[model samples]
Target chain A: MIKARITVTLKNGVLDPQGKAIEHALSGMGFDGVGQVRQGKVFDVELSESDKAKAEADLKAMCDRLLANTVIENYSVAIT
Target chain B: MKSAVVLLPGLNRDRDMIAALTKISGTPPLTVWQTDTEIPDVDLITIPGGFSFGDYLRCGAIAARMPVMRAVAEKAAKGVMVIGVCNGFQILVEAGLLPGALMRNTSLKFVCRQVKLQIANANTMFTRRYQPGQIIRSPVAHHDGNYFADAETLRRLEGEGQVVFRYAEGTNPNGSINDIAGIINGQGNVLGLMPHPENLIEAAHGGSDGRALFESALGIAA
Candidate 1:
């Protein structure tokens, strides 16, 4: 079994309102020197296939097809 | 004029859309369910608002992949008119039937109110009833109505006049880029917008600022 992790994040130049709100809230709570806060989604998927390369490719297709909105977001696949 | 409404589970605005199409077109629109793979011939196909699948994963993400959307895509490819409002807009974008993505509101809060909408391109069949540069009122209610696209795509949309509606003046409720409220597909038949034009089609619902849109799409004489 191969387990894969997918992280979907808003691409640079795309506005992140939720992330900005979180950043503001952290500052309101007195967290100092907080830089830009960006929000993203993570998915842990398991595949019965034992091939790491094939699993990674499948995960990427999953992101391209459903897991991420490629217009405004980018995703990374990590197999462990 | 014949029209149809796309129906999916957890959507609350199908009734409103049906009523609007019926009243405007003088014939009830066929309702295409999520599981249905076939949609009968119709002039306009509308996808209404409200949460679908509780908006899991992302707004319209799950619903966009349903069987009905495939049929919708097929119809759209054949040059049928398709309009998606609010969450409907999200679904169209998610389904890749339309350009750009509807992100969370800039305020991070659900916005439900009226905003002024300018007819960015009145030349399309959907907006022919409205005069060029005409401004009308539209009601928007959604948590994720902010639209985003790559700079290249944005440039093309603007250059091709695919942007059909823009928030007029300073009523940019969700911080959408270029204050875009509605857009049409590159082929010009499919439209996706955040505002609820169906909700304001009659006098009882207040001024009929949105009636012209339905009239145009339904081929009714204004």
Candidate 2:
């Protein structure tokens, strides 16, 4: 089995209210050096396919079709 | 005109949509489940507002992939009028039936209230009952009502007159670009909006400004 980790994050220039709230909370708790906190989603999947290359391609297709909203987000997949 | 409502799991406002359509069209709308793969013949299909799939991943992301939506898309492509309210609007966007994406409100809070909306275009099948530039009141309830699109897409939507509604009097509830409250597809057959016209269909609901939308779509003049 091949395991893949997919991370999805909003593209730059898109406003992220939840991330901004987190950043504010961190500052309120005395983490003054924190400049920004952009939120993202992570999905870990185990593919039954043994070939790493094929698993990676399938994961990419999944991300494009369902896992990520390409209009405002970017996704990256890592296979292990 | 015959109408139907698509019922996705976790949908809360399907009943409201049914009631509104039944009262207006004089016939009950057929409810199609999310798992269903075929859609019955209907002139109009409405996607009601609700937290489908518990709003996981994204508000309408999961619902957009449901089997029923495939049928909905097919009918819509053939010129069937489709109206998506709140979560339904999000689903249409996630399904790629409409442009732009809905994000969390800029205030980082769930906003639920009646807001004024200016009809940007009253010539579409869904807005013909209203006069051009008419301002109507409707209830908008959602956390992710803010609409975002690329600059080029925004310009194109404006140029094509696809912007159907705009928040009135600078009351931008969610910081949506150009204060857009609703939009129609290129063929003017699909409309997606954050406001719930289903919640405002009768005088008991404070006003009937939303009724004209249904009446217009069904070709029934008020």
How many steric clashes between backbone atoms does each model show? 0, 0
Top model number, DockQ: 2
Candidate 2: where are CA atoms >4 Å away?
A: none
For B1-222, candidate 2 gives per-residue lDDT tens digits of: 899999988989999999999999899999899989999999999999999999999999999999999999999999999999999999999999999999999998899999999999998999999989999999999999999999999998999989999999867789898999999999999999999988898989998889999999999968
Q: For each candidate, what is chain B's TM-score?
A: 0.99, 0.99
Per residue, candidate 1 scores C-alpha lDDT tens digits across B61-87 of 999999999999999999999999999
**DockQ of each two-chain model:** 0.86, 0.92
> For candidate 1, what's the RMSD?
1.0
Give stretches of model 1 more than 4 Å off. Answer: none
Residue A7, candidate 1: C-alpha displacement in angstroms: 0.9
TM-scores, all models, native as reference: 0.98, 0.98
Colliding pairs, model 2: none
Model 1, B102: alpha-carbon shift in Å? 0.8
Give, for candidate 1 chain B, the lowest lDDT window spanning 10 residues.
B19-28
lDDT of 2 at B30: 94
